[model samples]
Target: MTHQLTRRQFGAITTGLGATLLLAACGTSATPTSAQKASAGDKFKKASLTFAFWGNPVRNAYTDQIIKNYEKAHPTITVAQQPGEWATYWTKLSTQVAGGTAPDIIQMDQAYIAEYGGRGALADLSTIESIDTKPLKSTLDEGRLNGKLYGIPTGNNAYAVCVNKTLFEKAGVEVPDDKTWTWDDYLDTAHKLTQGSGGAFRGTNWFGADQELKIWLYQRGEDLYTKDGKLGASVDNLTEFFAFVQKLFTSGDGPTNDGYATDIAAAVEQTLFGTNKVAMCWMWSNQITAYQKANGGDCALLRPPSKAGSADKNGVYYKASMYWSISSRSKAPAQAGGLVNEFLNSTSAAALQLAERGVPANPDVLAVVKPKLSATDQLAVDYMDAIKDEITNVPPVPPKGTSTVGTVAQRHEQDVIFGRATPVAAAKAFKSEVEGLIASA
Candidate 1:
């Protein structure tokens, strides 16, 4: 399994605007009239709208039901629902944007919101009065770029370690209790776990650059980029991180960068942790379902190991998941805004989000849905909840060209591990390149 971003990765880099218009279903109302509301009758004007998102079939089904319910309640508005697999969603959506036929409402990854929103592709939803603007009060406030709210975050996500309990037991290594565990404890256990398993297994596997190391650096009181959009952190932190990974690589404790990439793609049962080759792996919280599918045996989630010798109580920050935005070119801005509000604030929409989306952003939705969540989903919910108060900052919307910077940071480290570049040289080069990207951004 190559753990790389899918074909949609291209969509991250380019913009396009070619897509077919999907009209809302038949007899849908266009807008709500005062008279219609006074009569307690279906008042929404007859209108057609399209919503586009990327997800698996289960998520698609849940979204469909949400749309169906909205249609039933209004009876005069028709919604055309479009779902794409991760591999194709970005490319297709980019094409729609380029062709000037983008969906009225689009589900967007937070990373691209800055680039697209900055380009006038996304409308400022704050201007719409139909939105509750309360449940997402904080979220909406952050999506603002140059003083406009372009996207609304759907919910929060964060990276965590998922350990194979069976592998831990088999290796005679103890899994650290989440609340008390530190980086040393995790690494110490990992060292033993890999050693005891011989060459057949390792301690951890996954992308280490931006996801694992940057977060670690933050916990250590450093950041990758500066407030002025220049390089902020020094090479020392990255060098230290690479040295640790190098030790793991040499000791056969962690897969090499390439090996880790393979595992990412296959996500197969035989790839280390999936096949019981490793004891731990880093994954987004939303991945619990995939992990459960790949490895049928018992597994447990844990916090990322804390930084060494740090007083900062917060080790991990909540990642605002994807954002929902309306195309500035959309003909039905008000209708799209209404849909966004309904999806985020309604009981029925909450149910759909619980089953399909990882967690709803609305606290009210979460309150109603928590009791019904599956064990894995509830784990994500609880983990995010535990860190909610501690989350200090959300990484700002990445600049246009820097979408590649996060991935490139990983490659630079890979080059160091492969002995293609010395750590200092790699760090210096990375700093210069990232600073240049931001400067041009």
Candidate 2:
């Protein structure tokens, strides 16, 4: 389906991002022409900075509150928010980056950070004293490319099984212990739940997403991309993973029925689990609050079932959900760094931020935010704490040439599921296609 940018989105890009992205391309620390020049050692100067990000209405609301707090604190700086949906955000940012018009402050993701950072589009964040590095010691490296810090993690997130408590109680199945559940056990329980629910709802909705692929790889003590940025899993591994995805869709006794394909593209609020049509599904723990707001906090988080039935050895890891990055070509690099500091350490931002961007990375931010959290938000935070010892370090960024890996993963997954190719053939072709991308890059 074709999607059109809303009036607000169009206005956001044309009115501000165009100019700012051009500034990013210029690679100059030229101050904004209209702002008052500041004294040498001042923390901030009077300036207008543009911050770009991807989000829906809910996240936009949170950001609006955060930005308001920042402006109130630093009365001279004004910020224009450039928000876009996930589907279009990267594409637009790429055009802006290539043409030298990237935003002053940008929301960076694991996939594209390397692409932009390696190409000198993102500022080296290590030189900025405004951004505190101590709090993010655990995850700081994930945002680095070749030892230069280009971004800072906004928060942490984990992929897990999300249970609909209301649906589970009605289906008469006991919740499985996340610590001990195995993939085999998960399938059996899903079958029982699906049978118990009759035709009104299914046990879960199977989704073929990159997040799932990563979790599956991690469970086997392997990774999707090696530290060197090459494809890590072999064709046999890909075949096994693809076959598992097909089983999830074809097995009506468990995770899916007829709606798996359609459901894959739906928003969080529209998913079967969110609409209370399923007992369980895999999702990022940070999304708990969004789904909870949609269906009430009648949901719970569990570690994804492990191959060996133990959470600790499952190779479960915490990923820095997203990041704050500055443009190498930004007009006001220092002020932009200060704004990034406020974004990461502000008490007001902490109070307003929940797991929407994942749990706060700073201990101080998490402490301040936890008391103010809604029940669902607390669950996300608590889940991370509950599994701290089991959590591994963040995965390596997918290298510069693999930003399109998500698209490649989704396409091959669909081909296998829809019978256009056998799992083995698809895996072979997928390995070839992905390796070729790395080689050409």
Candidate 3:
């Protein structure tokens, strides 16, 4: 009988696999120096590997096709596919790592690169001579930890404001020029959008995300994490950040706490922006396709607003959408690295995956795939290319244990918005909590 597995069921199954394998996801460990380094002329022996990734079913299908093509080219190697939703993928992978049965090749995220790479859970990609780093030289630095490359960027993305053009026109609002727009201008436009919609819609739905704070910090010549792995932005900067968000919530320019909660819980197809209840929202450039598909309207991408008088608008940077890394414990490291090289540089693989993962990091592959992208994807590509020269260097890879900062920021911001705490109090609490996390790590 054919059976479909629910997310919970899939997690349950993977949990058993993890226990048997003894894998731990993110934890403290001394770096291991035992992995065999691959030479340029090393030949991959015929082997089997388990490749794991987190994505929707559509992405799984695309990945399956790409794997099929890779197998056709190299018939001696076999890859077993393990796909799961993002919410549980890391947990399962961690368990597998601890059990020593981790997938051969892992789909990694920037948020946990420091955690995994620092702990020696990932193989150092610098030893893999088959993969070419020249095309994406500018982006390769993001996957580094202590000057060692652990992950290869699968694609590149950037944060931006996604607008429902149809909603903006219907509300009689002129789209602000992204080049000259400031944070104050963004607020005014949002307020105007709310008033024009006669309270039926909001101007934006993204006042609480930590990404906004990251951009704000960069604009002020600070960052979420310093190069030395400390909290870079001062407490006062965090206070201002929370205060601005609180103002947006109180001014009716954005969703209320309860409203925002409801919006977040809804499916993508039913989100406020998807339903045309918000004219704009902040999102990764790579997410434009799904947002536009859900909104069923003409969606436009705009750069995030800069500080009004600051001559240097350094808020923009290319972010690694995700990365491909091989587990250090993989029995077939050579074959696994070969697959990653193909995934990154093969023309056939790029043709099929296109920007589904994000814009191809390889310049040559990007050129080949640009014309094949959908309209919304083309917009993302053009947006990234246009801003490439203006953005600052990529921010430091998030420090170990720093992933919890996002949750802390969200909780404190919600508290301030709901009047449970003043912005200053929340900011102080956030600073203390984040420092504690970093110290504990």
Candidate 4:
């Protein structure tokens, strides 16, 4: 659910992509030369590389320490850190790539990986071997587009419902068995939590994000995009997706319109769930740490309610919370690969990150880090393990030209929720507009 750069903004970059060996798997590629393949992971060459990522101050400190430690390990290479906020990071990146001053190591996201890769801006990660990815297995597919690997997964995160045990306890309500919960159960619980507290705070937060919609679609054997990069969801599916979230507002079980905008944009510590204003919230697993820190209590993750009231039908899937990719423009591919290796596979680095980035994608690393993680982080890891069987396939790497999917989806869903548009009307407009966006891309 992280957006890289918008396609319109990338038009300038991709239009200049030449006969590329770095793009073999993403969008377009020509065969790499024997020399290029041979040099991919060559012995740590002496190179000063730049690494860029988006994060707040805490994550920045971790990256800074990781960089210092990496320099200590490989004295021959030096790294410069380029950190920015989410919006600013992508803006600066596009400018850098266009100017031929792109960083060597870049933290990537699923939403825009393909757009950047298709334009030949990322190295073919599959061509490199020194940076081992075997520990993560299939979760890496979230970074694969077209036919080749352009990005390496940093960790795995899943979208699910997080309930506050403290709120339930204060309301004198027993926590429902997530295993057998249905939509009715979810709605009922939200209502009871609200009523039990006499509206001191709302019951739940209503969100219509792509993650929330995908859970609903997956449970019904539907999906948003096909492997072929076309829309796989029907208008009817879109209608129901909007309709369901609309129930929260109509039933008076969710926050006010004024509060919805404010809460959704606030930090974890200031939001409803973070403030203990809601009994449950649908969110990415990576947020558990922040939510836990904010609430100062237990934040339990549960599988999203299913149609059949069974965990088997919950349709949860693991997504690489974020990723690492070597810039095609990098002069130090090996050194960049080494840095990514340190972040993803090094046990010491895993300890530094803990679950701040979600559960480590590598089981070997998780096995090492788990015992040392805080209780809330352990909760996240255990939740993922407990529901492994309920998970289906990893989501497809969003294809190039779909950068606006998340934004467009949220707008349409919000219209339905706020009663500004009917579900069916919003769905029709959403389908037409999204199709047009992809076509234009």
Highest lDDT scorer: 3
Please estimate how well model 4 matches the true structure, expressed as its whole-model Cα lDDT: 0.76
Q: Per-residue lDDT tens digits of candidate 4, residues 379-402? A: 788888888877775667766677
> For candidate 3, lDDT tens digit of each residue in 243-352?
99888898888886787867755667788888888999877888788889998989988888888533238487788888998888776777788888888888888888
Off by over 4 Å in 4: 1-41
Winner of 2 and 3 under TM-score: 3
Q: What are the C-alpha RMSDs, in order, of all predicted structures?
A: 5.9, 5.2, 4.8, 3.5
Q: Write the per-residue lDDT of candidate 2 for residues 1-441, one digit (tens) a residue.
A: 112333353344343434544664676443333122222234477778889998879889989988888889889889998998876786688667655677889998776676677666777777666677788787788798788888898888777889988877888999999899987888888877888888767777766556677778877767888888888878887898888877766777543434666666687788787787778877777778778777664889998888889988666677777899987767676678788888787776777765567788788888888887778878888988888888773577877556566667767877877789889988898889888867765
C-alpha RMSD in Å of predicted model 4 compared with the true structure:
3.5
Worst 10 residues of 4 by lDDT: 27-36
Where model 3 places Cα greater than 4 Å from the true spot, the runs are 1-36, 309-314
CA lDDT of each candidate?
0.68, 0.75, 0.79, 0.76
- What does the lDDT read for residue 203 in candidate 2? 76
Q: Residue 276's C-alpha lDDT in candidate 3? A: 82
Reference-based lDDT, residue 334, model 4: 66
Q: Which of 1 and 4 is the better model by lDDT?
A: 4
Tens digit of per-residue lDDT, candidate 1, span 18-76: 11212212322222232112221222656688999988777788888888888888776
